[model samples]
Target chain A: MLVSLAWRNIWRQPVRSVLSLIGLAFSSLLLVFMLSFQFGVYDTIKIGALGLFDGFGQFQPEGYDDDPDISKQLPGSQALLAADQIKGVSATAPRASSFAILANGDTSFGAAVIGVDPAREPAVSTLYSTISEGRYLEPEDSAAIVMGAGLVRNLGLALGDNVTMLGTGNDGAVAADVLELVGIFSTGVNAVDRQITQMPLARFQETYNMGENVNVIALRGPDFNGVIRAAPDLQGLAEAEGAVYLRWDDLQPEVRQMITLDLSTAMLMYGIMIVVVVFILLNTLYMSVLERTREFGGLMAIGMRPAQIGAMVWLELVFLSLLGAGIGIALGAGITIWVENVGISFPGMEDVLGQWGISGRVYPDLSFFSASIGPGIIVGSIIILGLIPYRRILGLEPVSAMGAA
Target chain B: MKPIVSCRGITKVFGKGELAVHALRGIDLDIMEGDFATLAGPSGSGKTTLLNMVGALDHPTAGEVAIDGQPLSGMSKSALSDLRLNKIGFIFQAYNLVPVLSARENVEFVLRLLRVEPAERRRRADEALAEVGLQGMEGRRPSALSGGQQQRVAIARALVARPRIVLADEPTANLDSTTTKELVDLMYRLNQESGITFLIGTHDPRVMEHSKRHIEMNDGQIESDTRG
Candidate 1:
């Protein structure tokens, strides 16, 4: 009976109740969409960065990442092939990288050169498709090199130009080679374009006297999350090969820190939004209770306990919050799913997004967990804050309430 | 017979210090069971204040009120509420029917507070409404009923619980002469038929004429007491 009375009472002033409901719904919608967009942007950044060279994650010699010395090389390509056997491992590429000096007609600059198998490198990295001039290295094309556009510009060289490379080999001998620049690629990433140069693995090994050893084994998976799930198994494989596994977080700590900072700032804003919504609900309910003082007094005069009156007010709030949250969840989820499918783009922000390692377009995350977070916080807040009106009802004196005009 | 309600030197003061207004001054009174009595007085004459004290709705400053041998002064708020629910019913000047409830629901409200089963509460509420000539109008809200009908519903609500005492404060003040007479006649009939005691606070001569006993007040003191 109390429940029935409370349910009917909220409708006594239909406009006021409806307005409060709309406010609650709007808050939930904004919260859900905001969180989904933030997570989507993070996903975009991870994919873009991992797509650069290290695909999803990598396995390298224990200290090779910090000191890319030719001497600290992996045993063989067998470990890289073994890692490819793991579930969800799309592909793997083994590469030997070293810093060397390249000179074209007296213009000499330092460049990071990578030795990769022509056929298998494309399976792990998208660098092959980014070629702007000439062609990628052929399987038997000895002394051939594919360099970034920035590197070519720095050395004042063009396609078909022969560049001289000078470096020390793994056996401590002078390693020298004159290589033809067969390809000029532009990755749009300033760092990669300015320093990276790739060549066929066999020619690089013969020039550097490194035999068949590779320094790093890069692994690619379906997506960022799928790669993270496969990390433990990949780590087990790396341990067997006496190598260390580096997940995206370990490989790109700066990106991880950037995401953490952004999420904290977003959560702070979400907290303020929740507080504002809770206050609005409190004000609406407090006014409603005050207006019905005389009615409450009448109930108390007829032997209704103060506790029962409090319970009635609480039930009314619970019903209103649940109704609003339900509607908001439906609207939020619908919009998120649509955005996820079609994607949303920030026009005129391409340069800024590119600087942050993301494309202008983003897809909102529409998972069940993401959709429920907003409405869940709202419902929990309303039930907890319902105490405001309950305390007010309990404090009312029947005689005073009855006499209130 | 023992008095169903008794008051001893009851004093009630509103506010405190220089702002205090003494609404009741050391009044003593008693009414036996089944008595139909009226406390007749003009406005600000302590009639309503005394009624409030007797109903356990307000606490006396320096006295005590007892109903059916239970002292009300020292009881907890919940205990006092329980006392009112079990032993007393009230009819207000404003009718005080819960506006959202239908006529039958308003009458059954007290039974619900008393934890009475639904079937018995409905049966008693229906019977009480029928007795007050509101049988077919049980489904109508207070807003849909006439002033006279609303007052009748209030009367039925007060009597439905079968309490020992029914406290009425100007229950007929909002009705016309004909409606007032019909309401008075209904209360008189209920008092006679069920042996329920009635303690009414009002200055209306019509209400005084229907009662067997009258106590008139002036300036927060009893000026006269009479019985036919």
Candidate 2:
């Protein structure tokens, strides 16, 4: 009976009920949308970070952090063997790197040219699939090269266009060459895109005048843990070859940093969402209880106990919470589904995200738990705020409440 | 005869120190079961305070009150609420029916609080509304009824519990003279027929004339007690 009475009382002023519900819905919608966008960006970073550059993990020199020179290269043979021994290890590639000036026509720009065995490159890096034009590197072609999209643009070069490379060899001798652009690729990272290229390891060896000298070796496997687990064996191989072992974590600290920072930012935004939602719900429920003081007092005068009155007030708030939560979930899910399918592409925004090494079109990617948590938080906040006025109602002196304005 | 209500040197003070206001000072009263009694006084003459104390809605500051032989001073707030629910009924000057409830639901509210069976609650609510001359009007809300009709609904709510005492604090104050007379006649007949005790506080001469017995208060103290 009291439940019915409380339910009826809420509808007695339709405007108030609706306003409160709207307040809840709006807060919930904002939280859901924001979290979805954050998670979308997070997924982008993860894909870009782990895709072309660092596989899930890497093998590197033991003391590679202090001296990142040719002497710090992890021996390729044992790392490759260890990777093969792991059950789920999918693919591995070894790399050598050097800095040079890429010049085409009158344009010249500094670049870090990475050297790899073309046959093994595709097994480890998504670079094989990222080619926009021409073909990927081929092992027989020592002079062929894949230029970064931004680097190609900066040097004013096209596929099949010949560019001159000028740098010192590993033996401290001048090395120079004309290299043909085999393909143009984008890693999305501005630093990589503006100043990097991929070429055959033999070509790099020929240019550097070092018959077998490689500065670093990058490896890839199905599991990041598999790569990390092979580190000890990789170190022993490097010791045998008088080289040091290094891992991808040492090669790319930014990947680890980016993930950590993004998650922390998401947590900060979540806190802000909670506070904003609580205040809105508190204001709404406070006004509701205030407006109904007289009716509550009357209910008391008619022999309804204080506890019963409190229960009625609580039920009304729960009803409002359920209604708002239902609407928010439906709306949020609808928007997420639509955005995931159709996607939202802002003209210059793609470039902006690309500059941060993220994908162009923003797709709302979310797990069910991540998506549902937003609305659940909003509803939970409303219920908690609804209880704020309960103590006041229970403490209401019936005579004073009756006379209250 | 057993007294349905008894008060001994009851006092009620509001506020503290220099700001203090004593509403009821040393009030002593007792009325037997089945008495139709009215407390007559001017504004702020402590009639409402005395009535509230008897209703168990407010506690006396420095004395004791008993409702149907149960001591109110020693009871907890919840216990007092239960006592009011099972023994006492209240009627107000404003005809305080919850405006959202239909006349029938208003009467049913008290029975619901008493935990009466749903079927019996419905039947008793219907019977009480019919007795109040609102047989077909039970569906109407308080706003749809006249001031007199609203008061009758309040009366029905009070009687549906079959309580030992009905505390009516100026129930006819908001009605016209004709409505007041009609309501008084209705209540008097109910008192005579059912032998339900009533403790009404009012300054109206009509109510005093209509009541079988009257207690007059002056300056926070009872000045006279008379039987018609």
Candidate 3:
């Protein structure tokens, strides 16, 4: 009877009740959608930044990530073959990289010289697909190299021209080479486009007197999650080969830091939304208590305890919040699923987004965490706020309350 | 046995200091089991104030009230609620039926408070509504019913609990003369048949005429106490 009475009481003012319900539902939906959108954007950043050159996971010499000196080399072929045997790992590419200087006709520029396995590099890196001009290196080509658009432009060199590369070898020998620029790529990332050049791994080993050793064994998988699941196995193999496995986030600390700051800002906004919802509930319940002042007095006059009345009132809010949260979750899940399929696009911003590793469109990722945490806060707030009216009810004297206008 | 409803020197003062208004001046009264009594007075003459005290709705400034031999002074609100639910029933002037409930639901509200089984509550609610001449109108909400019909529902609700005493405050104030007479007659008949005590506070001569005893008040003090 108490539940029935409380349920009926809400409809006594239909418009006010429905407006409050809609307010709660809309707030919950916004939180869920915003959370899913953030997750999707994070995924976009991870894929874009990691895919360009770092791959999802990588095998590097124990200290190469901190200091990329050519002397710090690992047996890459053994580690690459072992990583390839992992079920989820789709591909692996070996590479050697070091700082070097390129010169052409009195023009000179410093570049990061990257030696790649031309036959297998395409399977691991997005850089191979972002070529803006000229062709990538071939498996049979030893002296051919691919340069970024900005790097080649700065060197004042064109495709088919030999650019002189000068650096120190592992034995402190003067490593000198002249490489034909076979391709010019544009990745939109300033650091990559302005400072990188790739040549065949065998040619790089010969020039640097490194003897089939490489700096990294880059691993690729179907997606980020697949690579994550394979990290432990890859780590074991890398350790055996005197190297260390780096997960995507470990490989991109700057991206991880950006994600932390962005998540904090997003959560702050969501906190404000939850606070707004709390106020809406407070307003509705306070008005309801005041509006039914005489009615509450009447109930109390006729043997109803204030606690019982409070329970009835609390039950009303419980019903409202449950309905609101349910509707919001359904709506949020629907919108998120639709977005996941069709994706959300930002037009005329592809160049800007590409720099940060998000292609033109962002597909939202809806996880259980994103979907439930917001609505749980909303529902729990009502359960907690329901006590205010209960205390108010306890204060009213039946005689005076019944006499109230 | 003690009187079903008892009051001794009950004085009620509202507010404090110079602004204080004495709503009830020390008065002693008792209505025994099966007694039908009416408290008659003009507005602010203490009839309602004294009734509210005896009904355990408010505490008296001085002295005490006892219903069914249980003193109301110093009792917790929960204890008073339990007393009211078990020993006294109240019918107000405005026919205070929960607007959203049907006539039968209004009567069952008290039974629900008593924790009566649903089937038993339904049986008693139906019987009480029938006794109040609202047998067929049990499904009508208060808004759909006439003022007289609403009063009948209130009466049914009051009696359905089978309280030791039923306290009615200006129950006929909002009714037409025809309905007023019918209500008084119904109360008189229910009191006689069920042998339940009744303490009514009203200014209507028609209601006083139906009561077995009359206590009239003036300036918060009783002026006359009459019996046949």
Candidate 4:
């Protein structure tokens, strides 16, 4: 009977009830989209940073990350074979890098010269696909280098131009080579474009006097998120070889920090939005209670306990909030699924995204958590804010409330 | 027989200091079991205030009120509510039927408060509504019923629990003369048939004419008391 009464009472002011429902639904929709967008941007950042050259993560010689000397190389063939055997690892590429100087005629600049297997490197790094000019290195291309666009400009060199490279070799001798520029790649990172170069692995090994050895073994999988979940397995593989495994967080701490900060800010904003929704609900319930003061008083006069009256009011709020939240969840899930399938792109924000290594197109994440979080908060807020009216009902004196005009 | 409702020197002050309005001043009243009494007074004459005191709906400032020998002065709020629910029923001047409920639902409300079994509550609500001449209109909401029908529903609600006493404050004020007479006649018949007591506050002469006893008030004090 109480439930029936409460349900009917809600429709007494149809316009007000509908408006309140719409407000709650709008809040739910906003919450769902905001959380989805935030997580989507985080995924984008992880892919952009980890996909450039390192794949999901990398396994390096214990001390090679701190000092990439020619002698500090791992057994490349053995590590690559072992990494390939690990489950969930889709691909692995071995690379040797050294800080060297490139010179072309009167122009010269310092560069991080990276040695990579031409055919296998493309399978692990997005750098292969981001080449702006010239073709990527082929398997048979010896003494050939792929320079960044900034590096090419700094050294005044063009594609197919011979450039002299000078660095220390594994034998403590001066390693010198004249390599033809086969590719000029631009990854949109100014530092990488201006100071990184890649060459065929055999030629690099011969020039650096490091035979069949490399500084790092990069691994790739279907997705970086799965790779993160497989971190324990990756770590075991690294430990078996006396190597150090570096995930994206370990490789790019700054980007991780930025994501954490951005997430915190987003949550704070969402929290405020939730608070606003709660206040709107409070106002709606307060008005409903006020409007029915005499009715409640009559109920009390007829021997309705304060707690029972409170329960009726609470039940009304639960019904209203859950109805709105349910509708919002359905609407939000539909929009998210559609947006996830087609993707969203910011045409005018490409430059801004590029600065952070992210692409222009973003795919919203459609996970269970994102789908439920918005409606969950609204329901929780309703349960909590329902207490306000319950307390008001408890404090109402039947005689005074009955006399209220 | 002992009086069912007893009030001694009941004084009710609404405000304080110079702003105080003495709504009831030194009122003494007694209502015996099975009595049909009317408290007659104009607005601000304290008839409703006295009725509220006897009904345990308000506290007297300087007096004692006892219903069925239980003094209301020190009783807890819940106890007073229980007393109202189980021993007394109230019918407001405005009819005060919960607008959201159907006629049957309104009649069954007090039974529900008393935690009566569902089947018994339905049976009692149906019987009470029939007694009030609202047969076959039990499912109609208050808005769907006429003023007289709504009042009948209110009467059914008040009588459904078979309370020892029913307190009514100008119950027929909104009804036409014909409906008012019918309502008064129904109350008189219920009093005679069921041996239930009634304390009504009204300025209407028709209500007074039907009552077995009439107590008139002026300026918060009883001015005349007459028995039929």
Candidate 5:
């Protein structure tokens, strides 16, 4: 009966009640949307970066990352042996990579030429599997180059087209070579697809006069657990050669740092929303307590304890908060799912995100854990705020309360 | 007869410092279990303050006030609330009904707080409302009822608990003369029929005339206590 009374009291001022509800809902929605956007961008970057690159962890030769010179290559034999010793290491590939300028007619662009053992490369990176149309490199196809789709277009080159590569070789002499385009790889990351060309290891060595050197050996691990398990020993080994063992995280510290900062920003923005919601609840409940002060006194006047009055008020708030939160959570989840599916595309901002190495379409990716936090915090805030008005029950002046106002 | 309420040298002060108001000064009184007494005084003459002290709603600044023979002065707040709840009922000038509750729920409000069984509470609430001549009006909210009807509901609420004493503070202030006469007569009938003690504080002459006893207050003190 008290619940019915309180529920009816809330509707006494229809406009105020609705305004409060809308304020809470709007606050909850904004918080959810911000969090989803941050989470979505994080996943998109992680997926895109790992697609072209190797695993969660990588093993490279001494000074290869800092200098990346072809002259710094570790012998393929030693790299293979070290790759085998890393626990949780799923697969590894030895690659000979170098910087060169490629030319076709009047169009010329700088490119990173990668020489991979094609069979093992697929195990370490998704580059071979992401090939949109043409076949990936094969062991017998040593002399051929596989270019990015966009790079192939910009150079006006295609399968069986000829391209020239020029570089200062490992011997400190100028060198040049011509190669046929055997295939194309599209990893959906524009930078890699537009500027990288893959060839077989022996052929790249022969053409670039690199002799028997391999620039870096990259590895793909099992999962998040595998990366953590293998990091310490791999770091130790890389340091022995004065090299840096970089995991996917180390490859882009700024990206990870930005994600951490963005998540905190998501929390701060959403925290402001939650606080607004708390105030709305407090206003509705306080107004309700004021309106019903006399009724509370009447109850106390006739054999009803003040504690009972306090309990009724608390119960009423719990019921209303549950109702509001139920509505808010359902609305938030509906919005989250809708946004996660079709994604929100910022027209002019796509290039901005692309420049930051983020995707153009913002897909809101909400974890089960992340989505659950919102309602928990909202309900908790309501309960904590509900205590303020209960002081009326303790100091309830029955005569004045029953008298008027 | 043993006194149902007793006040000895009870005084109540309001506000503080230079702006302080002394509403009641050294009131001493007692009423037997079956008395139908009215505290008659002009406005600000300390009648309401004495009544509040006797009803356990306000504490005296000094000295003692007791209800049902237990001292109310030094008892814990919860203890006083218990004394008020289990022993006393109150009716106010404005009828103080919860606007959102139906007449039945208003009465049930006390019964539920007292943890009365649902079926018993409904039956008692029905009987009380009927006794106040409000049969078949249990479902109406206070706003839907007339002034007289709402007051009757307040009486029913006070009486439904079957308290040993009922305190009325200007219970007929807003009622028309005819309605006031009817309400006083109903309360008198309840007193006669049920033997419940009644203590009414009012300035209305009609209320005093209808009462079986009257105590007149002057300034901060009672000047006369008369019994018919």
Candidate 6:
């Protein structure tokens, strides 16, 4: 009976109750979508920051990443075959890297150089797709090289330009080459475009005297989670081959740092929104109790306890919260699910995010955390804050209250 | 018969210092079981204060009150509420029914608080509404009823619980003469048929004509006690 009474009481002033309901609903809706969008971007960054260059996870000689000496090399072919057989592994590439001096005519620049298999590099790293100019190197072209647009420009060279690379090889001998630059790529990263270059693996082995040994075997997967699941299996493979497996988070601490900072800032804004919504709803509840002072007194006079009156007020708030937030969640989850399918696109914002190897569109993650946490906090807060009006109703004396206008 | 409602040296003061106004001043009174009594006075003459004290709605500043032989001074708020629920019914000048409730629901509300089963609650509520001549208006909310009809619903609500007494504070103050007479006659019939006690506070002399006993108030004291 109290429940039935409470349900009817909220509709007594339909306008006030509906308006407050709308406010709470919208706040919850905005929170659900924003939190989901934010969660989705973390997955995007996980791939863009690491999969763009570092290949999600890696297998390297135990000390290769810490100190990339030519001597600390692993069996490239064996490790590559072992990594490719993992269930989630989509591609694997062996890489040999060394710093080299490049020159074209009167210009010269020192640049980081990595030798990669022309066939496998395209699958493991996005750098292959960023061929801003001429075609990528073929497996047969041992003398062909690819250079960042910035590196090529700094050397005063272009496509089809012959660039001489000079470096010390693993044999402690002077390694020299005059490779034709068949491709110039622009990675949009200042570090990569300004000072990085790549060449065919066979040529690197012949010129640097490294045989079939490479410093690291990089691996890629279907997605961030797939690659993560493959890590344990990859770990076993790496150990057998006397190397260590490095997951994306361990390989890039800065990405985790960036996500944590962004999430913290979003949480602060959500906190403020929830507080404002709760206060507005609380005001509505308080005023309703005040307006019914005389009626409450009459109820008390008949037989109703102050505690029963307080419980009625509480039940009213609970009904409002459940209705308001339930609708918001339904609407929020619907919108999120739709966007997850077709994705949210930033039509004119491609160039802004292109540098990070990010596309113009993103799909919201839509996990339980994003869907439930916002509305949960909101409804919980309204119920807790409702105590103010409940306490007020409990304190009313029947005689004086019945006399109130 | 033994007194169903008792007040011994009851005193109620509002505020303190020079601002203190005595609402009820050292009044001693009792209404025996099944008595239909009325308290008449002008505004500020303490008729309502005395009624409120009798109903256990407010505590006296000094002295004690006992309703149906139970002392009210030391009772907790819950216990006082239970006492009121079990022994007293109430009617107000403004017809203080919960406006959201239908005429039938208003009567069932008290029975609900008493934890009566649903089938029994409905039957009793229907019977009370019919007894007050509001049977066909069971589904009508309090706002849909006239002032007199609303009072009748309040009367039914008061009696449905079979309380020992009903406290009515100027219950017909808003009604016309014809409606007032009809309402008074209805209460007289219910009092005679059910043998339930009634204590009323009013300025209406018409109501006094129907009462079996009239206690007139002046400056918080019983100025006259007359039997009709």
**Candidate No. with top TM-score:** 3
lDDT of 3 by residue, A29-70 (tens): 888888999988998899899999999998888888988888
Who is ahead in lDDT, 4 or 5? 4
Instruction: Order the candidates by DockQ, highest first.
Output: 6, 3, 1, 4, 5, 2
lDDT of each: 0.87, 0.78, 0.88, 0.86, 0.79, 0.87
Docking class of 2: acceptable
Give candidate 3's whole-model lDDT.
Answer: 0.88
Query: iRMS values in order, in angstroms?
Result: 0.9, 1.4, 0.8, 1.2, 2.3, 0.6
Per-residue lDDT tens digits for candidate 6, residues B74-183, read 89888889999999999989888998999999999999999999999999999999999998999999889999899999999999999999999998899999999998
Residue-by-residue lDDT tens digits, candidate 4, B2-90: 89998999999998999999998888888999899999877899988888788888899999999998899988778888999998889
lDDT of 6 by residue, A1-405 (tens): 889989999999999989978987888888888899888888887888777678989887777777878777886457455677788888888888888899888788898778998888888888877898998878898898999998888888878889999988998899899999999888776678888888998889889999877877788988778889887788888777777888887778878888889889989999998888888888877888888888889889998999999999899999998888888888888899999989988888776666556677888888788988998898999888888788887888888888888
Candidate 1 vs 4: which has more TM-score: 1
Could you tell me the lDDT of residue A155 within candidate 2? 84
Candidate 3 lDDT over residue span B91-201, tens digit each: 999887899899999999999999999999999999999999998998999999999999999999999999999999999999999999999999999999998789899
Quick one: best lDDT, which candidate? 3
Task: Please compute DockQ, using alpha carbons, for every candidate against the native two-chain complex.
Answer: 0.69, 0.49, 0.71, 0.62, 0.53, 0.81
DockQ of candidate 1 compared with the true complex:
0.69
Q: Candidate 1's residue-wise lDDT over A1-405, tens digit each?
A: 889998988888899999988988888887778788788888888878777676788888888778879899886459566677788788888888788999998899999888998877887787887799999988888999999999899999989999999888889898889999999988777788899999998888888998888888888886678889998898888888788889998888888999999999988988998988988887888888888899888888888888899999899999999888888888887888889889998898887776556666888876676677877888898898898889878888889988888
Every model's TM-score: 0.90, 0.80, 0.91, 0.90, 0.81, 0.89
Q: Give the range where candidate 5 chain A is weakest over 10 consecutive residues by summed lDDT.
A: A75-84
The sequence of per-residue lDDT tens digits that candidate 2 reaches over residues A92-177 is 67777778888887889988878888887787777667778888898797898998788988888888899999877777787788
Q: What TM-score does candidate 5 get on C-alpha atoms?
A: 0.81
Docking class of 3: medium
Best by DockQ: 6
Poorest 10 consecutive residues by lDDT, candidate 4 chain A: A75-84
For B1-228, candidate 5 gives per-residue lDDT tens digits of 999988899777889999888888888899888899999888899988887888888778887987788888677767777787788888888787877789998888778767899999999999999999999999999999999999999999898888989999999999999999999999998888899999999988888887888999988898999999
Say which prediction, candidate 4 or candidate 5, comes out ahead on DockQ: 4
> Global CA lDDT of candidate 1, please?
0.87
User: Which model, 4 or 5, shows the larger TM-score?
Assistant: 4
Model 2: per-residue Cα lDDT over B88-184, one tens digit each: 8888988778877899998998888889999999899999988988899989998899999999999999999999999999989999999899888
